[model samples]
Target: MTIQNSHNTLPLDPAQPERQARDEGQGPMPPQAPTPTQPLAQPTPQAQVVPQPIAYQPQPAAAPSNGVALTAMILGIVGAVAGFWAVVPITGYFSAAFGFPLAVAAVICGHIGRARSKRVGGVGRIQALVGFLLGYVSIAVMVIASAAWTVFLFIGSL
Candidate 1:
């Protein structure tokens, strides 16, 4: 077969007669006629959607107590004040005696404070312990000095 070429058109391949026919404004080839051959297949089944229920959970909250902290602070202050008084000269002995009780109270208050603070949150454990220690030490020294004074007086009288 021979290829035809126009002045403004490119040459077409003779081997592609079907393409050349369509390019020349010919309609596309008619669809092939169907034949009664086999039976049609059926569609497959789809899955069903279902909703799920969620379980509810309760949470426990933290409970804080401020009383212990307040008591601790007050006791610590009292211990410090008493301990300070005990450090003086004549009044020192009486102060130390008074400070002993205050120190004991401070220690108890400090323990309570630490427990409450752990539950709530506060500061002053160091101060409470120090006050308690100082008060107790002063009380011990006072007792020893008093005993020594008594013994000395008795010996001097003899």
Candidate 2:
């Protein structure tokens, strides 16, 4: 059997030389003239569409009822007033117990109030903070007085 070269590829057109000779004899074809088309007119400037002003409707303010800030303020005032009775050991003991819970309640109320105020875009954040702080201070004073009484009693027994 005769050996054939695997790398040798066949040309697509065997008459390539004849085609090239014919193309060389004939020069490139001239471009055709464009056809006469209807001319387009410039568009007229459109009238400026002025937007009418919308009537301003005022939104109603949020009601103070059912607000945590109001609740916190009320509770804090009550706690602070009750803290005065903390001068007496027994009263202080009772006040501490009640005051601590009230203070915690005030704090929670204040936090909720502040968040709600931010959401509704109100203006009572400072009042809420004050209420919470006062409530905590009242509770602390009551607790301190109660502890002192307890220590005094312990010393007296010894």
Candidate 3:
């Protein structure tokens, strides 16, 4: 048997002249040259290389966006301001008409924002809650003012 080390090949048994001759770039010695006491070298089996499959690693999901919460907050603020202005005598009628729709839209956006925030580990949760409250408050104020105006008109007509 022979061991291959880098570019050099070494024989397991140094006493074998045929292995030494073969390792040193010389062809194997003649069959008659081999002595009876020394055994001949058997051919070594070649090793086959097998490729391994790569492991699969799961990636983390991306964080949710805060834009919805910000939009909800802005819409709620505008709707609330409109609702307050809806109490005016003349312009109130127009404000009431516009404010109610804005408040409803604010409420819808706030609900979506809050749900998204919850999924994103509480990011923008406070803004979503604030918008939700403001939307409800605006709706309530507009409703009350509109009902009072209607009642006053009804009584005046009677």
Best by TM-score: 3
Give the per-residue lDDT digits (tens) of candidate 2, residues 1-158. 12237975444554443454467886444433332464556689999999999999999986654368878887787887777567686667777677777777887787787777786567677667767887888877877787788999899899
Clashes of each: 0, 0, 0
Ranking by TM-score: 3, 2, 1
State every prediction's TM-score relative to the real structure: 0.39, 0.55, 0.58
Cα error, candidate 2, residue 65 (Å): 6.6
Q: Where does the lowest 10-residue lDDT sum fall in candidate 3? A: 29-38
lDDT of 2: 0.72
For model 3, residues 1-158, the per-residue Cα lDDT tens digits are 77888898766774566767787989887665456687877878888888999899889878667778888888889899999887886677788788888888888888999999988888888888888788999999988888888888889999
- Tell me the deviation in Å of residue 65 in model 1: 3.8
**Model 3: pairs clashing at backbone N, Cα or C within 3 Å:** none
Model 1 Cα lDDT, one tens digit per residue, 1-118: 4445665444354335456668888856553333346444566877877778878877787554556556655665666576566545567667667766766676676666666555
TM-score for candidate 3, residues paired by index: 0.58
Clash-forming residue pairs, model 2: none
TM-score: model 2 vs. ground truth? 0.55
